[model samples]
Target: MEWFKVVAFVVCVLPTAHCASDAIVWCYHLPSCNDKTWPTISPQYCNGSRQSPINIVSASATPNNNLTKFTFVKYDDTSAMTSIENTGDTVKVTFKSGVKISGGDLSEQYDSLQFHLHWGNGSSVPGSEHTVDGKRYPMELHIVNSKSSYNGNTSLAVKDSTGLAALGFFIEVREAAHEMI
Candidate 1:
């Protein structure tokens, strides 16, 4: 609900349609509704037992040998670029056709919908969603996917458990940027 307000503010306040990252910062770090004040937004955010971006405690994690290794289908295949747009909140890349992900705790294959980036202004502070042992990353990449069980109906799939999945990666700053960037 509050995100919509930020979107409107960017559209009205900025001369151009584009929204600077600084404006987005204010929305996320809102004094009344933030990570610390998540309960104010919704009970699900803080009060609920199920939550995301949780700290992964390695010591308590148990590895399962039966888990299969992850595999991607048609991932390297060359395809025509669909569209790339800056949606004020995030820069997103869309593809005409999606790649299928199989294995690694997934009983059913999932197809990629889109990929988005979360980053800060290149500061020492981190801006990623998830943290490891309470340590955050400066940037994060999330490849969203929906299970084949959905039959291509993302809207319906989202409401069901195990209908969606997201592959996340930490982006560490380096001396040279990747060619893909």
Candidate 2:
């Protein structure tokens, strides 16, 4: 009975294993791994069904009139842009009043809240979701905002991934700069 069971298990598994094909693998490019510089690594798997990268070759690619544009207006209050300082793994930023970002499909005017930087431990890696030309930037800034424009309202835009929009700035910090936090 034991011999029959083993034979049955193998018979059922062997064909399925043979019929399975490889899968497209995705990986993040980080600045460092295990406190050391991140090494160039290839994807773990490759298969024929993998999707190809799209490149718009048409020169006529233009913005449609129906498309909403998000306008980032520079407020005269320099204080809104200040107060950004790196603290270990995180960077904090504060915005002053009269600073507003509008346009696009925004249902309400967004007011700046505490923003932070998310990045890998090294220079080579970028800690963000979207990559440019498969290359990672050194750091990514997440300028968090609130749609309600009021504090202690329990309306954190960051809490809802689909409900909020984030302005991501990919930066390469090569030198130190004085800023507020």
lDDT of each: 0.58, 0.44
Residue-by-residue lDDT tens digits, candidate 1, 73-156: 777867723678897867897645567777867668887777787677655334766666776666777777778778678766
lDDT of 2 by residue, 1-181 (tens): 1110100000000111111223512334434332122122222222212111112223644554654766555555665665777754577887765466666555667665556765676645545433454544555666655564544242343344323445666565443344546
**Candidate 2: where is the Cα deviation over 4 Å?**
1-66, 81-85, 119-129, 149-163, 172-181
What's model 1's overall lDDT?
A: 0.58
Least well predicted 10-residue stretch by lDDT in candidate 1: 4-13
Worst 10 residues of 2 by lDDT: 4-13
